[model samples]
Target: MKIIGIITSPRKEGNTAWIVNKILEGAKERGAETQVWYFGDLDIQPCRGCWGCHKGDRGCVIKDDMQKLNDAIDHANAIVFGSPIYMMQMSAQAKIFIDRMFARFSPRYSPYFKAENAAQKKLILAFNQGNPDSGLFQSYIDYTKHMFELLEFEVKEVPVVTGMRNGPAHEREDLRTLLKDIGSSLVGE
Candidate 1:
């Protein structure tokens, strides 16, 4: 299985990155091909809402590194989206990446609204927050998961690492072990 880990955190060595990498490590150990992409290292532009993608099969007009991400998603059996909560929501990088995903969906908003890659690829949503309480953003987390489901992804898990202001995820052995297990579970083992 091919799994792609997308890190939307600006800090390559931040808590979110650490969590994503740890999970990817478990997948790698299970012999699953894995690749990690950092948003900070890509030149992905925000969607302009031009409806150009819907006009035909041209896809997003303002092409950039997002096309690479789209191609990766099309080929991946699973995807891990990792982001750090900013202002009680996903980071700007994550938001922009999600917005660019508009090209993957049908333009119709009726019952026919369907994503092009509606193959039910497994998805794992990972988030890190400074707040000590994990439930502080449960509602938003659920919303985000639902959004991915609407995009036709079979969301498998939503792991939130709280109290990150105290320390990075790399220092939390408990979380590391838990996340690694979660990742291993993705390969159905």
Candidate 2:
């Protein structure tokens, strides 16, 4: 099996990346091929609202690293999205990435609305917030779930680490163990 992890944080090796890597470690242990894509490192352009991809070939018109990202997502058996909440929502990077996925789906009124591979992808959605209370970010998480569902991804785990700004996540054994356990469970031991 192949698993792709997409990190949407501007900060490298930050809380977001750390959590994704920990999950990848578990998948790796199960002999799953794993890769991580840092959105900040890629030159992804915003969707232009063109319906070109919905035509014959079904490919995006904008040319950039998004082609590579799309290829990765197309082949992966599972995907993990990691991002830190910003202003009560997912980071701009994450939102842009999701928006770009418009190429993967045709208009709802169209005859070919859903892709053939739709509903075949298993997804893990993770988030890190600065607030001590993670409950405040439930709306953000729910919104993310809705977006992934629109993409036809079966969301599984949503490991959230809250109040990390007050204390480094490395010092929080509870959070560390939670991430590791979630990772192990992803591949079913």
Candidate 3:
């Protein structure tokens, strides 16, 4: 199995990246091929509300780095999306990446609206927040999961690391073990 970890945090060594890398490590230990992508290192731009992607097999116009991400997603059996909560919501980088995923779906009204990538891909949504209470952003987390479900991904887990203002994820052994287990579980072990 091939799993891809997408970290949208600007800090490469931040809590979000630590969580994502730990999960990838567990997946690797389970004999699954894993790759990690840092959004801060990519030049992905925000999606323009253009119908270009649905027009005749043509994908998103004005593409920069999202094309590579699209191809990676198409080939991945599972994906782990990690982001640092900003203003009680996903970071701007994560939001942009999610927006670019629109190209993967054709409009329902169009005749070409078929499940192009019908295979249900497993997904893990990981988030780190400064708030001590994990339940503080439960509603937004649920909404994010539902949105990805609508995109045809099987929402496997939503792990939120709260009270991150105190320390990074790597410093918390409990959180590290929990995320690693979640990653291993992704490979059906």
Score candidate 2 by TM-score against the native.
Answer: 0.91
95: Cα error in model 3, Å: 1.0
Deviating ranges (above 4 Å) for candidate 1:
108-113
lDDT of each residue in 1-189, candidate 3, tens digit only = 999999999999899999999988888889999998999899998888877887877788965988888788889999999999999899999999988777787555243345577347889999989988988999999989887777777889999989988976777879768888999999864
**Candidate 3 displacement at residue 68 in angstroms:** 0.9
Local error of candidate 3 at 48, Å? 1.5
Candidate 1 residue-wise lDDT, 1-189, digit = tens: 999999999999898899998898888889889999999899998889989988868879986998888889889999999999999999999999988887787655333465657458899999999999989999999999988887788899999999998987788879878998888889964
Score each candidate by Cα lDDT. 0.88, 0.82, 0.86
Query: What TM-score quantifies how close candidate 1 is to the native fold?
Result: 0.95
Q: Name the top lDDT candidate.
A: 1
lDDT of 1 at 112: 43
Q: Using TM-score as the measure, which candidate wins?
A: 1
Candidate 3 backbone clash number: 0
Overall local distance difference test of candidate 3: 0.86
Q: Candidate 2's residue-wise lDDT over 14-71, tens digit each?
A: 8888888888887887778899999779999888877787878848899999899988
TM of each candidate vs. truth: 0.95, 0.91, 0.94
